[model samples]
Target: MTEFTLIPASGAAVPAEPFTGRHLIDGLWKDSADGATFDRVSPSHGVLVSRSAKGGEAEVLAAIAAARRAFDAGDWSFSSGKSRSEILNRVADLIDRDRERIARIEVLESGKPIAQARGEIEGAADIWRYAAALARMAHGDSHNNLGPDMLGLVLKEPIGVAAIITPWNFPFLIVSQKLPFALAAGCTAVVKPSEMTPSTTVILFELLEEAGLPAGVANLVLGYGDPVGAVMTTHPDVDMVSFTGSTGVGKRIVAAASGTLKKVSLELGGKNPQVIFPDADLDAAADAIAFGIYFNAGECCNSGSRIIVHEDVAEALTDRIAVLSRKVPFGDPLSDATQVGAIISDEHLGKIDGYVREAQAAGAKVVIGGGVLAVPGLDGRFYAPTVVAGVTPDMAIAREEVFGPVLSVLTFKTEDEAIELANNAAYGLSAGVWSLDVHTCLNFARKVRAGTVWTNTWMDGFAELPFGGVKESGLGRELGRFGIEEYLELKTVQMRVARGRNNWVAG
Candidate 1:
């Protein structure tokens, strides 16, 4: 094991008491029917963060019933788009006003850098504003080409009661990705945030109430996947399920939701790649590559965990990325100076280390940082920013989602070979290409199997662009106009304007 620089916790104040989180049902906040509760200790700070109601079948059932009633009664589903848009915009404003507070809670709960959490809060607010605009711009198509006797209309309507299950990695941002869009589509929802981080969602619910969102429009249940998430997926009343998590768990959600045959939209795992060419700007590519792998401590679905580089620049590019990786701050997340923070848990830290060790045992060379990090005055778990070289396509570290600040480097000779190497994984959520030539960038983008392809950039996302995956990466899309469509259903209406419809019977 290597000893790296230790970062001590900032002397910032901790909450005197842990936050109290309860279920929000029918515009009321209450405890679980059985008085069950759970607690979250900060993964970075080693202190209690929150205590939340543990929702079981009874609580989940209540939330589903509330959403179903809210949808069936048309209180929100039939409301004017302008009304919904106004409320969404107000929520956006509220989010911006409380961005710092929300960011602090997220940092404490998720063990991510404070700066990154703050940026996510800002981005989440922007998504809310975008969803608000989407609400008003939503529309139906009218077919005027039909004969004068007949008119056809295609209407987009809310899918009704939706069950939204968000993961813990990017809690606030992920929920913002799903909930606002579902509401913008005029659907009521039962939401279950990961039990590990539930306070921020509770805060968002407060903002929703303050924004004048009607009762039973959006409900929250805090608990584990079993009982809570399981019921949300299979319930007879749930019209749709939008989930963001591991592909394995995503498969389970699909199978469970199949019982009801409800609509399912998933944003799952990724073993994303960034391909570097000989003609690429080495300096720029190296910088982006380092950021891609270390951002979110590489606990992101879009983490650029593996790099496929042309043989000509393989050694030089690998050295540059290795040098850059060491410079990325890995320490206490509370300090603004820290770039990478603690792993989510001791178990997760072990899982990340296991992948690296297995790769090393299989003949992979670690260029730098191949062990645990010791941050002063903190007992929380943290892994070093590792760079493994000589990684083969068949190696697990190169093909699997390591979900840590670990980078794997592999080499290729030709463009086709690079594309083949990039597309070799079972997951294809995203990929990036680095090249100055227009033809190479376009050709590689066209050949790649990922849902989102970046040219000369890695993980530059926007609210206007659609995001999702193909194959085992999971199904459907989120964000942009297509995102709102996930919560909607289409209906065709044909009318006979001229006296009466043509009759088959003898007149």
Candidate 2:
């Protein structure tokens, strides 16, 4: 038995009554037609956090119809760029004003550290501000050099309505990444956040209403994926679908949308890697590796779950990370001192531990903590930060996404071997290299198949750059200029200034 130090629960006040959430169809908030609702128990505190109207086929249809009607009405779709930009900026200001309220709900429902949740809210606000900037700057092309008698014009228009489905791991942040951009493109939308964490999104809708968004321009449904998300994906009225979740679900969305042939954009799972070379700054690399795996309790889609290190320094680096892993606080999410919080659920905690146990059974060695963590005075489920050494490229722990604070270490003797090992996974979301040699860094960055590659850093992101994945990781990109384009359609207009076209009909 391994006895671990746990941070005690903080004195932060829990609400006397759970939050009540409902479906936002058109511009009105209403309960489910059948009056069925679901409750969310805080994963960290074991207290009732929220009770939401469980949406079914009827709610889904109603929301979709609202978005379709709004788009067709052209009230928002045909609005000037300046108008859309102003609304988005106002929404951003509201997000900042309600930052504490949203962050607290996120911390309670998602079981993430309070500080981290606050940071995510801040990041979401920044994304909204960036999307506001994009609204006014969006433009099409024009050509006057076709000929003296002819002119050409290209125009970008909104893609009717979009269905946005987000996951539980990053409820507010992920929706912020998608919805504001869709709105900025002059598109109406129906959004569905995960049932486990729907209150933050509910708060966002309140902000949207306060911002004076046109009625039915954006609607929200609260529930599971089957009736809510399935209808959204296959609905003929929807012009596009943007989802962030697992790869299996991503594939299902693609298949469901095939019948209607609606555009589908996904940001899916990852088994991201961080490769270390002998010439790297070992101390800096060690600190980053520790942060990468432990951050978010390794539940991030871009989590660096595995490391491929050169043979000469593999042992030393692994030891360093193991020591740091033990030092990361794992306890109550309400505590500002806790770095790693409770697992989202007992089932997910089991899944994480199962992966590490299987790897150890197959010849991998546990370098540090390897089992459940008991936080003082709390009943929430937690897993200790684990590092598994002697992992081979063929091991399941090395190839699959454990989505936990578990790190797998594998050694490579040559650069080609490192690249081969890094590319062996079914995912290509992100990869990182930590070498001081500029040539070495450049070579790896060029050769890696990931959507985002870091030379000496891990998980540095900005609103100006596009983010997504390749292969099974996902399809299309989000953020940057490309984000809004996903919700837009292009049209070309050809004109004849000479007042007549060529006599193609022989008239």
- Name the top lDDT candidate: 2
Q: Model 2: which residue pairs collide?
A: none
lDDT of each: 0.92, 0.93
lDDT of 1 by residue, 1-507 (tens): 233445687777778899999999999999999999999999888999999999999999999999999999997998888999999999999999999999889988989989999999999999999999999988889997899888899999999999999988999999999999999999999999998889999999999999999999999999999989999999899999999999999999999999999999999999999999999999999999989999998999999999999999999998898778767778888788988888888888999999999999999999988888877778677888889999998899988899998999999999999999999999999999999999999999999999999999889989999999998898888999998999989999998888966689977
> What is the Å distance of residue 35 in model 1 from its true position?
1.0
Per-residue error for 391 in candidate 1, Å, reads: 0.8
Q: How many angstroms is residue 258 displaced in model 2 relative to the true structure, after the best TM-score fit?
A: 0.2
